[model samples]
Target: MDRLSNLPNHILSDILSFVPFKEAAKTSTLSKHWHHQWQSTRNLDFNHLYFANRDSNGDVQLQPQIFIDFVQQFIANNNSPIMDKLSLTFSQPGDFQETVEKCITFSVDRKVKHLKLDFSDPTWDENDLDGLAHPMFDLPQSFYNHQVLESVTLFSCKFDVFGFKNFGLLKSISLGWIELKVSTVKALLANCACLESLSVKSCWDMDSLSVCGKDLKLSSLVVEKCHFLDPSFEIEAPNLNYMKYCGTVVLFTVNGTSLEEADLDFGPEFECDESLGDSLYQSLNGICPTRALTVCTYMLQVIPMGEEPTGMEPRLNVTHLTLRTAMHNYEQGGIRFFLNSCPRLETLTIDIDRSRRICNEYRPPFEDKFEDLWRSSAIIFRCITQTLRKVEIKGFKGTPNEVYVMLYLVNHARVMEKLTVITSSEESNNRGPETFRSIAEQVYGFRKGSENLAIEIV
Candidate 1:
């Protein structure tokens, strides 16, 4: 008995929607009733790389024409009147420009709510010199006239902001590897009246950016690795709740009172300067109201230099704090600064970022010993004694610094409830079971402040 085949057509179509279109198409062979169900799927995701055949050397042999033909056939056969999402990822648009235009037109005509087009060449390294020379696909004029688009993601595509129209319904947009002028970005934001989220990464031809609008509904913004972007970044979105920035230290004037979370990674220590320290201070002060904060090793190194000579009082309202570092001795001052500042912090997370170990060589030599740094500190953080409940150490290797810090937290956080140590994949592979058992025994032997504290090693 084929009970699944006996199900209602709409139910079968809904079920098929959960499977990839390629796999869903295979269900046609199951029964005559299932033959047309796939055609009614609301979401269409086609990746040309997935269709490409591999050669003897395992190199991808792109079949652009074959992929084009398959997509054309699918669109022709599909009977769905409306689409929830349409994602097309392919390269070499010069080989089939018309087909690509037609696909965009089809999605717009079907009133797709979500559209993602990634034209990044899979064979090229985007960071390489030659890769920067790769041409970008120009979006068709029809792409600008959509009235139902709610979300859009574009990668390695070139298009003018002047072509934009009727984006009243658009809510989210993500752009990567695109050359956009600051004015062009401003114009795009002006057009997206209802936009709630925007992400820009690796964009070029922009030295400065300002995201300011009184009625702007944007709630989240992400900017990363725009090498040309200078230090003058200004944001004034009162509705913004989340922001993630990764790049060189920037002079930021963030005025979002609603900001709740921020992840800041100011790249290598080589980029840091005394003036940049003030900029970092200003940036951190602007987002002081953030309830949850995440910062990298670069920020840790710069914070001490940025602090006032008289020393500012604990001002951050952060309840949850995450530090990404190499746990080097130079970072001790920064770590202490954060512990003192985040008075209300309830959850603490330390992520060992191995890539930041290179920063040690560039940083000025510190006379403080790693083991003695914490043990010598007499300052009592209010969070450790009263508020902190959980602590997590990721990329743990059971090193002396890690063990000392773990013991310090275990012995100090009187109200703490749990401590979790997640061993790094590299450490787990290199160390034997006996080594782990020894580490566990050491953790268990620590004199905990809270008798009910639960400890876990994974």
Candidate 2:
């Protein structure tokens, strides 16, 4: 008389997909029919969070060995010949690394398509004084030889991938907070001919890294927060569609046939070789046909000042352009040339500094009370903003300089349909309602080209 005993096995398996592996196995207590049904489940999703809250006294360590044993025994008794995915994230120093190696071997034996291993402790921050714990598990050589692995993600592990011979179907790979030799990364990428997405974040200890192959089919690449000793790279991805680099710019060469979006962040006191900007400008030359572009204020500062973009043409087809500036520097105003470069931009967004940037609080603020605020050389060609239909200003404080910026956009963007003004919580708390009223008065009286233009402030 079980409520779900009559459901077909396919329907039960579909329902089990919504629950974690351990929870799904609990159905065995419902009736004798379910005793062996969970064994045939195709996914081995063992997450520590599923059983983590039951910990005694909220200890940072994993909840208990019962949950661990349940998952291990379940996988040990698995009968499925082919698993769709095998994701295990038990980020504590519980089992030996050999146990994880066996689990991966088990997945490979069953022809698992997607595999994820997150052994890194979630609470272990590298910046903490005594943060080292749960040593990075070393991946077995056989883990890299599995041709059925279409996607693989490894966290907090050291991979000696230099010996890998084949990554036949691997389309995506993400490694975070891991350690690896420079030669190992090079060999791994050289073997992954079909790699489409690559993400490497917060990894350390490298002098130089190079990834280059004429037949490489990478489409999306992200390199974030990897503070290397001598950060350098040489990447040639001819088919990359999306790329985001959020760290110190390395000396690298990345070229692609076509790119749809590119986000570059060089804030947070990150820097690169003097030649980085120049080389990046050349790499961008390959993807000048990009539709969406985002750059932080630090990179914007560097490109205008140092990078020799003398002969480079502007990316006119960019439909969306986002600029990240420091909260305080939003008023000092130096991004006019960057805007003009994107001629066909349909949306213009101004964001606060990407990460926690050390703001210079000692300098006195500047106030400019001008009717015609924008005086940059780029403003002479106000006709370039014909396609700019929407404008959003985030972290807007009612500083006099910010008022000037608002006035410029209100004056220039003749056909703009909507303009949104969003203030940071701190600004809303500190500044009274009069500050907003003052800015609203100017916008109310500003002569907009479209009579239907709507300006909303928050």
Candidate 3:
């Protein structure tokens, strides 16, 4: 029956390309026809964990020598002239560092386009206050000057930024769990002329970051959890369309008017003070041109505390907005502030934070009625009557406050076409079918502003 093995060589090579390198190598044991087929694969991914041996008691025993021998054997057998990608992930190279350097040289000589090298130690405690030293893996100089590389990802590695050569064709770069200086980062960015995406996460030793280039083609940027980074951050790329930042509050000076989406999260541990609120307000104002936006609970609580700029309306151009909150009483003011600022908002989504729901015992509940709090003034928001079309409420628990807010939106949003209520898993598990049926009936009986309104509950 082995009819699949009878296919032409090119067809077999194409099929093997879709399989992982380890699994593809297993095909060689199936039949003689497949012995040489896997050698033609254009992509190679070697991970130390994949080749780990287990003891009789089922404890993992890392065999660096075995992994090294297997890779060397593959390189000896592989005859491919060009490689699309080469990835190597290992935790402890120990005395085999020279072999790791040789592997990088081999991939570079073959003109691999995408490269990923991860040497992170999985057992290292990321949250340890004492800060244990990270495993060090230095990249060879051969990887710096490659003209054919289009994307590169490095984790827990060190390399001389001054040794960087012309990376004219590079389009993406990601660096995580590493130590980098401001000058090194700037030098790297200056050399990669064609880069479109850049991600830097969990890095340290930099006090400030400033990415400013007029002719740069970068369209996406992400910076997260760089603990040593100072409060000052800056960006001026004109073509940037997407950005994501997660950390403590910082002074942001963004100048990208082409931004289409942005996600900002001040970590859950953030506490708002007047100065921090002002800094957050400045950051938000700078990114107001974004079309779609996502914000966290801490941001909602702090935004209302910051003062608006002089002579500025404090309006945002966002059409779609997503809020991540614990549904605490403090977040109500922030929600109202966003509703008033986004005049043309079309879609609204509220995702309740489940992890913080039970732990928010210190925060007090809303003493005023939900309807009265939301509709205290006669000034009607423009989006409620003319712009908003769809609303989604996730993690619905059928609490009194939740019900009041739902009814208020049903009565106010005239142009709304659809309302979706997604109940939490806990609510469904604790309630019976009769309770759900009663809820559905109550929702159906509510007065809707739009005659064509459609409701869904799940």
lDDT of 2 by residue, 12-109 (tens): 87778677778787888977888877766777887777776535776655574765776678767776678888998877634555566778888888
- Candidate 3 structure quality by residue, lDDT tens digits, 244-348: 988767777888548899999885334656566677777888776889999888877666666641112667888999988777666776777788888889999
Clashing pairs in 2: none
The C-alpha local distance difference test score for the whole of candidate 1 amounts to 0.79
Q: Which 10 consecutive positions of candidate 2 have the poorest summed lDDT? A: 361-370
The C-alpha local distance difference test score for the whole of candidate 2 amounts to 0.67
Provide the TM-score for each candidate, comma-separated.
0.89, 0.74, 0.83
Q: Pairs clashing in candidate 1?
A: none
Give the residue spans of candidate 2 off by over 4 A.
1-7, 15-43, 53-59, 126-134, 141-145, 160-164, 270-289, 300-317, 330-332, 352-358, 361-384, 392-407, 417-446, 451-458
Evaluate residue 248 in candidate 2 and report its C-alpha lDDT on the 0 to 100 scale. 65
| Model 3 poorest 10 in a row by lDDT | 357-366
lDDT of 1 by residue, 1-458 (tens): 87887888788778887888788878888767777677778889888986789899998899988889988988877767888989999887788899999999999889999999988776655344224765789999899878889999998898876555577788999988777678877998888889899998777667687899989999999988765546677888889999998876777677754899999988633655556666777788866689999998877776666544212354788999999988877677678778888878899999985657435344432456777755654756888999999999897776677777888898888999999888766644478545754675588888888977999888
TM-score ranking from best candidate downward: 1, 3, 2
Judging by TM-score, tell me the better candidate of 2 and 3. 3
Model 1 scores a TM of 0.89
Instruction: Sort every candidate by lDDT, greatest first.
Output: 1, 3, 2
